[model samples]
Target: MIGPETPRRTVLRSALAATGTAALGVALAACGDKDSLSEQANSGSDKGYIAGDGVVTQLPPSKRGHPVEAGGKLLNGKHFDLADWRGNILVLNLWYAACPPCRKEAKDVEAAYRAYKDKGVRFLGVNVRDGAAAAKSYMRTFDITYPVMLDTAGRVVSALHGVLPPEATPSTLLLDPKGRIAGRVVGEVDKTTLKGMIGDLRT
Candidate 1:
């Protein structure tokens, strides 16, 4: 919570927390008024990145979680297409090795993963600002076994919303099998609270 961490150094290091978008207008205004609809008709079968059909099943713009980019790569060099994770419950967290709060939440995240991973759940980690080495060390020390993507440039964080410093580290986002956000822990991981939320999601 010291000051804004630069996107170059560390996305998570910027002391940013979930500010949540104020409105889609401000969020989308920068794009100007481009009628993507017109492009779809002209292209016939849309396949390009900027085509109107580029978006599939838009998941109510996430004010907290990532925008679910086209292609995300894991630390292990695996690929995660957002569409593929649709059928399994996904747990997402933004963390950094230096954040004290993130360190505290690591154990809880590991415990939850251990408990629910085999029960039709998937966990994804976004390590911003830190490299594979730091992430590996942290994972090793904390016993985290889930697959995580290294967010070298913090694109995922930017997609969530501009973070504010003193923001809670280890922020959590729980998504249903359908990929919609079911719950979030914006400030630290409260197992009692998270577990209760998880119980609700199952119901």
Candidate 2:
């Protein structure tokens, strides 16, 4: 027998559907129970968070956004302020431990950092989610020596609200020496491409 739909039932159904969808996306992205939250980010699902599509956008100096003002504590408990890195190009990467794409691109990121670190280019990581232990473990596993900001509360993400929200788990933002956003990569960054961008910024 068919019954008339009630408001309570309607709301419940909607809620369940949304929950299921989110769970499904996460599961697919995660691939396995052992996969960390960062690895799951590689699925590129559009449940709530933005999924990176490997798109690169470089803005001309005249059209670049204003300087970014954000700061947070690193995984090792050291405070990091973006302003301190001024006068040098900064590469900021948003990542998490469980993201597969993030893991895949870690080496490339480190290589690029090594290639440009002595040339006045700096690299910082923004761990979107995960505890310090997890983040530190991931870094150790990936051999990433760069300091990563622990953004457990999304403070850094919120600070970049309009200019660069870092909607994707593995997003990369390039800041010119003046601290203005110069380039952005929505997904895993390509090593050569990143090196090229940094080279151009130096000129």
Candidate 3:
């Protein structure tokens, strides 16, 4: 006694039916209800995080507002100044240690960083939550080498609010060489999609 599977249901089921940690991460991303990080934190549900539905938004040069500016102390106790990397393409990722999508995409992000780090591209991670210990542990676990700005005081968040809202736990913003936001992915960024975005910025 089983029910028929609708086509939409079949697709969703297939996506969720994959095996391993990646599949679990995709399932979690598809289940997020609340969009705001602050709202999720105060909901008392103790869910720790909410995943995004994987939305990518791009801004044309005319529509991309002023150059974004944000700087703060990194986990390594070194002061990071975004102004220092002004003439290079930059990727800014917002994440917290406990966010599943963040963990899911860590490898891809790191791989991308390694691939583009030497080609006039820079990647900066902004840990919106978690203190030094947890944030450092997450980076170690993921073998991440990119410098991450520890956003304990939310200065990074406030500065980049124009492009990246507090909606997605693992959002990524791609900035042009001049530091204006060119594109953003509001979820676990697929490696190919991220690469494409970066490639587009270079043109």
List TM-score per model, in order: 0.64, 0.72, 0.73
Candidate 1 lDDT (Cα, 0 to 1): 0.54
Model 3 per-residue lDDT tens digits across residues 118-139: 9999998988888989999999
Clashing pairs in 3: none
Alpha-carbon lDDT, every model: 0.54, 0.64, 0.64
lDDT of 3 at 98: 80
Model 1: how far is 158 from its true place, Å?
1.0
Q: For residue 126, give model 3's deviation from the true position in Å.
A: 0.5
Better of 1 and 2 by lDDT: 2
| Runs of candidate 3 exceeding 4 Å displacement | 1-48, 158-162, 165-167
lDDT of 1 at 46: 21
Which is better, 1 or 3, measured by TM-score?
3
Candidate 2 per-residue lDDT, tens place, 1-203, comes to: 11132111110001000001111111100111112222333333443244453345566676554566666567778877778889999999988888767777789999999888999999999888889899989999989988887767765554443333335667788889988777766556768778978987898
RMSD to native for every prediction? 13.8, 15.1, 11.4
- Superior by lDDT: candidate 1 or candidate 3: 3
For TM-score, candidate 2 versus 3, the one ahead is 3
